[model samples]
Target: MTETRKTVWGVLSTANIAVNQVIPALQKSERLVVGAIASRDEDRATAVARRLGIARAYGDYDALLDDPEIDIVYNPLPNHLHVPWTLRALEAGKHVLCEKPLALSAAEATTLIETSKRTGKNVREAFMIRDHPQWLRARELVQGGALGEVRAIHVSFCYDNRDPANVRNQLDIGGGALFDIGCYAVAVGRFIFACEPERVVAEVDRDPDFGTDRLTSAIMVFPGGRRLVFTCATQLVRSQDVQIIGTTGRVSIAVPFNQSPDREARLLMDDGTVLKGGDPAVETFGPVDQYLLQAEAFSELCVSGSVDPYGLQDAVRNMSVIDALWSSEETRGWADVRQD
Candidate 1:
């Protein structure tokens, strides 16, 4: 599509993830410009806007969403609030690219899909890792059937933080390991399989003090006898990796999820590494930020009005699997996923 002008983005929150990560990356995209920033506190909004060199600051989220000039809304709110704010933004005549796990449940995700349809605006889940070059290569490797039929996939992401004031620790505000880092694990399995899981068996360790899950592990069985085992944690040493085993061979990704473009990503193969006694086959990505790539992609979709290949439907599907996982934790057995 032809670009007439850059897409103007207005952020819905002063969340640290926005201030530190997404907004900075969005600014780097030539196709994107930070139009405004908002917070519930006027002074806080002004301070963040000045610090980030944003054009406008609003004391409330409604002001940013109501800006007629803002072409896109970048929402980085807490998990439970994602759908509500995204609906508000779409109703205000703006496209949306909300943060991951777009909604708390499959029901909420379906609601988001219908709302976006009614509003005639495109809304997407902000899974930046999907657009990264390294991940693209991994997808090609897996979907290409390098090792024949995929038998199992193992993915893990972890971090250690005990901040009491952080929203991640607040159960009432959608605080939990599964909703936070575990979303990445679930997304990875879904992406690699190129299909949804059929059933899930999960177990979670909830924090007694915070009343939120602190660690979670799940096994999802997809069609054709494929299984995915994943684990995520909030109180563990920082770590991330994904390994896929197939009937023919195996694929390993050293830096699978939370990655920096500046770093080198290794896609290891058993045949090349074990017998050859050589280093893992490596693919280095551009210093290009994944967030910038996602932003530019969203801008293209906004300008072209093309169908988003993995927007609401994918969000809803992923959330449905998540719902099964959560349910499995309670049932202490397999919970079936609803493909219908």
Candidate 2:
């Protein structure tokens, strides 16, 4: 007997992320089927659905959410809309795989988590870097003491998104360099360091025309004196890299920061040894594959009743760090990360 496919997914936006990444990933995953695409504009929805070969198209998000056949919902909506639509999806009896920064603030993230628990549904943030094999290997190596007690982590993610009308330039819709790119740096720091920072200090740069931050630099100090210094920007030449230093040696992840990085990451030891590897074929890298992995993982949770690896708790914690960073900038002093 042939094994049955595991999941059917609905996409809630016609955002570029869906068109470029998530749709292709769903098409590639053996465990998932692309069910439908939804956009606020009927014509755009139909066009994206037809172009992507998705079977169903909905003119509105709720119509797609109401479809019982859609087992998982991929939400790549704007940052401000994440909590509202994710909650709506859960209430509609659909599991949600929302893009990162989970919400504009930690309080919003907490509300979503509480609602997920109340509804007994799976809700996860889409932090695709965690699913990458190289990062997985890095985590294993670090956890196993290959680097001899991690002392510090340095990461940077930057790109030029200076378009006046780009969503990242819009303040009210939750557009800012910190929310867009800083979340990745923060997530990576927390993931590798194995704890959220006790305090955050940050500086932000705002463009005159946009009235939103275009660049940010932050320092996170974790317990045991480990430090993660990170920078994110929307007005710089593209660069993405991470370095972890320990007592015995160091590991460098070349271009580890991008939505799609083509170079193999490098690992170096104090003994003059170097290790190099490329992206895993088992997963797709960049915005699209990341969303797909999130979809597949949520499907597995629904089918098997397993704990979500990147669950609501993780989302809340990440948002809390973000909130603290913003607070640090506001007061020009270290802000303690608030936890609930």
lDDT of each: 0.86, 0.82
For candidate 1, the lDDT comes to 0.86
lDDT by residue (1-340, candidate 2, tens digit) is 0136658889999999888877887788888888999999999999888988999999999999999888888899998999999999999988888887789998888888667888778888888778765677677778999778898888888889878788889999999899998999899988998877899899999988897888899999999989999988899998888888887667777556444533344443342244344332222223334445556666777777778767988888888999999899889999999866
Q: Considering every candidate listed, which one attains the maximal lDDT? A: 1
TM-score of each: 0.96, 0.91
lDDT per residue for candidate 1 within 48-146, as digits (tens), equals 999999989999999888887899999999988999999999899899999987988899888876778888899899999998877888788778987
The C-alpha stretches of model 2 lying farther than 4 A from their native spots are 1-4, 259-291
Candidate 1 — worst ten consecutive residues by lDDT sum?
279-288
Candidate 1's C-alpha runs over 4 A off are 272-278
